[model samples]
Target chain A: MMTTKNGSWKIRYILLLIALPVLALLFSLCVGRYVVSVPDVFRSILSRFNENIEVSKLAYITIWNVRLPRILLAFVVGSALSCAGLLFQSIFRNPLATPDTLGVAGGSSFGAVLSILLGFSLIPLQLVSFGFGCLAVFLTILAAKGKNQSMSTIILSGIIMGSLFSALVSLVKFTADQEQQLPSITYWLMGSLQSATYSSLLIGLIPIAVSIIILFLLRWRLNLLMLSEEESCSSGVNMPRLRMVAILCATVATASSISMCGQVGWVGLIVPHMCRMVFGNDHRHLIPACVSFGGTFLIIVDTLARSISAAELPISILTAIIGAPFFIFLMRRKGGWNL
Target chain B: MKLEIKNASFAYKNGRTLYENVNFSVESGEMISILGPNGAGKTTLLRATMGLLNWKSGGSLLDGDNIADMPASKLWSKIAYVPQAHNRGGSYTVLQSVLLGMTNQIGLFSTPKEKDIRFAEETLDRLHILHLKDRLCNEISGGELQMTMIARSLVSHAGILILDEPESNLDFKNQMIVLDTLTKLSSEGIGVLFNTHYPEHALRRSTKAILIDNGKVQFGATPSIITEKNIESAFGVKAYIGQFETEHNMIANVIPVGLTKDEEKTEANEEDSDVLATLSIICSKFEESERINAILHEFNDILFGRMGMPHRKRNLYLISVNLDGSKERIKMLAHQLSVLPDVSCKVTYAKEEES
Candidate 1:
């Protein structure tokens, strides 16, 4: 009886499977002036996969090299931010909490921008940016760790650390030579994957991949964290240790994304809540949903940023414009302010 | 298994001592209620038992093993806790929230199996609230929310259930439901330690009671041991203990003097000389003995000289006095009145109700 009842409920999973491709295709096609037909895109992908008749080199390059990289980067970055956000929200057990809200992104932005203007091109500027990102997060964690491990204390530390790095970033921006360094630093701060090289993608890839893998593995622990500390403790979780590990994983993922992409906002803060609103807050459903949705959502957003103007707009500006209104809508729909 | 606390003391970081030097024990299958006032640390004691707090001093044990030394995961299998429902204001569905109870068993990639789902469903069914299985947690009524939390605790299947104010947010109907469930869980050999402000709930749900006040264990015993003195000590107020027969069992109501409005106002009115003058004048119309008996009847069972009244046994007597200075004196007065031969006395005295 149990088996039949449980087995009969396979339609939801099947629907998710069915919807995934349709969403992916729609996301892929929505970007760029050269509107490639779905069939043509599919044929191109299929021929490339099957090693069939030689396809147009321009179509392959445009689809595979230009559009696909940008789309995949958006997806990967979005997934990283949202996953990190979900992890932070559950760990802190607060909806207002997110991975970037802790100033990890701001710190990384300072590091990346500093490396950019200072002309420290050695060791791949991405490494320098990621290093500074890790440093800022480490300092914030240290500040928050002094007292009893309370959620409020950690949030306060994040705010303090975020402000400090932000001040430093402003300082660096103020003194920079206007001709050479200003535009580059501004572009970096505004945040675009336009400069997304296969090399740069590889640099961002390690941390995002590692962080997502860790989050997926600790999904059960993340769910447990939503319970009261007492309940979590009694449930056999080495809660403090698990919490530290989760927070570290989230920090690394967020910091790495920030270093590579340069301050992509709201995806970390808003996407998880959106994911939870649609899929229930079970981490099993929540984690995967956030990853896929975040990736798709960001891909669409970046596509819009690139295609809407004669010149490509910075992705961060577009994200804030779209994301802020959507976030407010989510907040209203959730009716969280009433509480 | 036995849960033991050997001189446990708890204080917040601000040096606000909640409970200090408290010692108590609970055997397997026993249901105990820890009763206290708002700031008296009933919740803190529960937190200590669950090893959720860094105790200022002293120790807690689960079946002779020191809880502080035990890892949280290992300790969890032995004890499951349901905190007050109000704290869980997250945007989680009832089923999803309850399924979180299987955190120890389920892995990240792994889906919930038929057994886990069945266990969760059964727990909800046992609480008779299976209809709310798919509802968002925030959308549910507070009573149903409390029931869902209980169901979540049940799914953990721990040897012990520690509930901190499980009845606080619940209405009377849900409170009764929880008491019934706790009683059943206890009967099934799960030791239950619940903190409650309601004396009646303690009497209904618990085989034993631990009265906490002033950051200490004031009294720990069976419901029978929860006398007027104990109530007064735990919450500095005199209570009117009324034992009444019910369809299923005997019901004991410990209505404190200042807590019940109708009772407290009448006590205040009795002291008025103007009312006394009017009563004196009316009494003069009847014979002295008949007037005395009539005057006694006019006053609700809270006053003196009640010999026979419907629902009141012929052995009834009433003791009314103003409580001065402290609860200890009022308790002494009530004790003296109760000991009077062939009389079931009611003591009514003015005292502040400790919220």
Candidate 2:
């Protein structure tokens, strides 16, 4: 049952959602391992435009170079993964779909493992990882559409293709040297944002940003993708084209984010579901909600990952530790999920 | 608007051909019903006619253009389809769900405009579901959700409406609500085509009916196609279409009593010889009178004398038509007139075809 909601509560709700990511970004910048005071952080950020306001060189370097790019990358990867998750779930009409639903994570991890074994540098490894991620989706589509086209067959093929890539990754891991390559492979597979340079951000930004923007532009039609096949087709949309474009975009976003940062896992599965719990299932609200809350959730998690201990913790560990319980609590209170 | 399927045939891969060379035309202001047993390809015909599925050899045409050749957006903007309610967990609010109907009208990067939303609201209001605008679609009853889906289709401003089992999961009253809405929409000059499992519903409401039994398809005027013998053969049951005389008019119904245990062909359609009769009609509204005129025009060759008198004070039109034709076509014309809203027609024979 729904109460007769006035427009005032809706306005307040939208404002609160929009504010979360902005506030999280600010809070993340000020309270890190090298703690810049809040006012000093704002002053230093503003000092670049006005040089008359004196700022210490160390604080300047730490705020602008170290924390800014890292947290910014955190926002990018976070939103990208969650948007991908939301898109896949709508496309498959299944609540359990994730950014890795089409095997992008498995395929990209195998590519990264192979790259490390072959002693390839960072850029080539990222490219190889993205290329394989796309290849996995392509193969899944081909297999699913081989004889007769159906949604259930596609889901089955994705599961098969995903496990195949995971097995291949394990084979590569079994072949890597224990002392040098294995530990690095294992660590990277656990996921990290420590290598979030400005260049890495630039590379990862294109696919994620472009796809997210395109998806936002075609936001309402995303609702149609969740409809049954006949219902969707009759809505006067070019459903095949819409479906192709959406799936391609979600794939690129998920693949590029995995290539940029290793495998920050729980944010993709949890953030979109959290948004649905709060905002309901209208894509007009769900898309923007996923973008904002996803970015905010990851910024907070990554901030804690870097600051909680002397050595950096894997971002995925923090995400599960924080996200799982919160997700469970929200589910219980909200009384379960629907799409 | 006219949607025509010409020589279209369909079959699943490595399976029996469902039907061959099926052809029918549905024009604007006409209500057509499709009745078939399970697995008779009732739904598949609708899908292929809309080009959602490809036919084996032939295809459908909208006006003069082939449906398969037109762009999806162009074709769908002119033909709205409401599939059967699936009791899905989709939680989009009723307003938002209906607003998605304007997807093809809005641009690639645009949300629906204020004008589009107003149209959606007006459509829901027309369907009497305006109060449920902010309610979630899944949270409503099956009938409400069915109406919501129909409203979504109507908001597209399509000239032709197709529905697949729009009344299947509903109670008697809910079925009447849906069927009456469709009938009213059809009278408003939008071509309405729907698949129904209830033969009585088809015979009672449709201007034309298509029956697909096993792999054979038959299409004709509603009364002629949904005869008692046809129902018996199609459904494998001993059934009869009985006329129940009410105070206002003669309403026809189908009663299925028992299943057939033996395969015996019943040649019971031999009583359609020439006869002379007069059909008296009372139309409560101008629209119903106009519909009556259209139906009478089709039998003008057999009709001889016609008279119309309008009582302005009472808001009713009293008319009588003399027809000299086969018993089948005359009864069909009377049945067509009787099915319309606020229209009652009775046939009185001058020369009866004796038993």
Candidate 3:
């Protein structure tokens, strides 16, 4: 039964969602190549503040430098992508809408590959990718402008732009040297948090955090966006202005997340639906629920990606492997897309 | 508050004029019904008056101020719109859905406060749907959903409530519930305007009626404007106008008989003849006088001479009318008179002479 008496139960559910990610973060910090015990992990983390605590120097370096940034980056990137997906779905009024529906991911992928082909360093590569991701959406918007620029026209233009940029990505891949560059490009497209560093984390965090805050403040209005354009307008919402702001915020979040982690697919699309199953479709609860559940889900997936075998698998492969079955299970249990 | 549309004309982008020189005014506490056939620009006129559509000429004035110049927030604060009932499927609960109507009242970043929630609750209680506050909108029946929408609009405290066919696709009880709610709202000094296909609903509830047909509009009091002739001309259907005596007062009913195809030919041929008949209509009781009056007024085109006398002691009204038209017209008038329950009529035709 879907109860609408929102009281202590809602707060309890939200607290549980928040606790899951924190627990996942703790577990992920212990599951790397240099396995550190839970107590030792805490000591290593605590030793950063307290010099009196005796912890292994290797454990300190491993936990702080390698696993901590990777875990935090995965959580941030996941939360950013899922919230973007939620916003996009609300604005487009389509349950199937994702961050990449507006060509952001495709454009960023093209940019990342082009920068790699140009032999740019990691920081510049991510910057170029983020810039092109925004540019792709900008161009899509430009293409959709006309005498009567309907929502369908904008979505259609996004599809066209996505395909165009994807073709460009393939062209870049084709012209590159097959031995070193091609494999690197392919691995990069598959997505991983293996290169997570403090500088790279900082680079992605600023935009993601800003966009997230903006979306959080605008979350209540997102409920109105679920209504028809006429109803929203009649209800005193400036539909065009709100939609543009939402799109800009979602695009920024998505582009920044993709720049950090090459293309973590399905986290954006699936986490919100999963959250909706737990928390009802009201955006007030649904946005925060998506954030917590998404971060937890990706952290666990990243942990499994690094710990599953002797050679680490890409995060995308593990996400698809885990996410597809879970999605099918949700479909079977829920019977249909109630949202 | 008065919403006045002065000589408004609207043309579509395709150069098709939907309506021209449409003029009407609705004041606070007045219920106006826009009655017409499909494609008659009833919805178009409503949208144009609300400034949803750009009109070629003229404008809508609210309390002598142009509505176009007012900001949307201020405009929406004063005017609430309840669209058709079919737009009801959503995941929000009834209270949450109704709270959305306070969008203008609440700031952009703030959520609905306790006062706003109390207002929504009071509105739901007023509409007798308070028990449905926690139910998801999609889980409720269509009638309940319609009530929820009305409650939504009511919470906004809008002075003018415009509904687009609030009773469409509803069962008899649900339709009555919706119509009664609308009437109650209008009686509470909220100017109500609704467009509907049922002329009987217009006759029963509306203080004023606007009949739009073939790009032209006829606006006047409901009883004077919505007649058998207007219904037939507007919808290409023959209508019978009659009245029923309720416990409190007499209410008129417009019943559609069927479509008429050769009306133009019949009208043209009937104009050439002059057949005179005298109709003596007797209402058996005094309470049936209103029904008799409505029937006389409905067929007044052919009725030339009319006189009425009430037998006070016996509680009866005897009405005598002399009608001049073709033989078919006189017969049609007599046929209409014979249908009332307590009314009887005797028609005496003059013998034909060489002219």
Q: Once model 3 is optimally superposed onto the true structure by TM-score, how far is the C-alpha of residue B95 displaced, in angstroms?
A: 0.8
Clashing pairs in 1: A75-A295, A234-B76, A236-B73, B19-B215
Would candidate 3 be rated incorrect, acceptable, medium or high by CAPRI criteria? acceptable
Candidate 2 residues A22-43, lDDT tens each? 8998899888778888888988
- Stretches > 4 Å off in candidate 1: A1-57, A334-339, B10-21, B54-57, B107-109, B213-216, B247-249, B258-355
Give the TM-score between model 1's chain B and the true chain B. 0.70
| Native A-B contact fraction in model 2 | 0.67
Q: Which tens-of-lDDT digit does each residue in A1-339 have in candidate 3?
A: 223556778678767987999899999998877788999999999999999999988999999998999999999999999999888887787778989988999999999999999999899999999999999999999999988898889899999999999999999999999998999999999999999999998999999899888878776677788776666677866778889998998999999988888999899889988877776667777778888988999999999999989898999998899889988999889887756
Query: Pick by TM-score: which candidate is best?
Result: 2
Fnat for every candidate: 0.55, 0.67, 0.40
Candidates, ranked, DockQ: 2, 3, 1
Candidate closer to the true structure by lDDT (higher is better), 1 or 2: 2
Per-residue lDDT tens digits of candidate 3, residues B1-355? Answer: 9999998899999988888898999999788999989988888888888888888899999988888998888888888888776654347888888888887788877777778888888999999999999888888988999899888888778899988888988999999999888877876789999999899888877777999977889898776577777777788888898766544224567777788776452242235477788888788778878867876787778889899999999888888899888765665556445534456677778888897
After superposing candidate 3 on the true structure, give the runs of residues whose Cα lies further than 4 Å from its correct spot. Answer: A1-7, B263-355
Clashing pairs in 2: none
Q: Which window of 10 residues has the lowest lDDT sum in candidate 1 chain A?
A: A1-10
Tell me, by lDDT, which candidate is best: 2
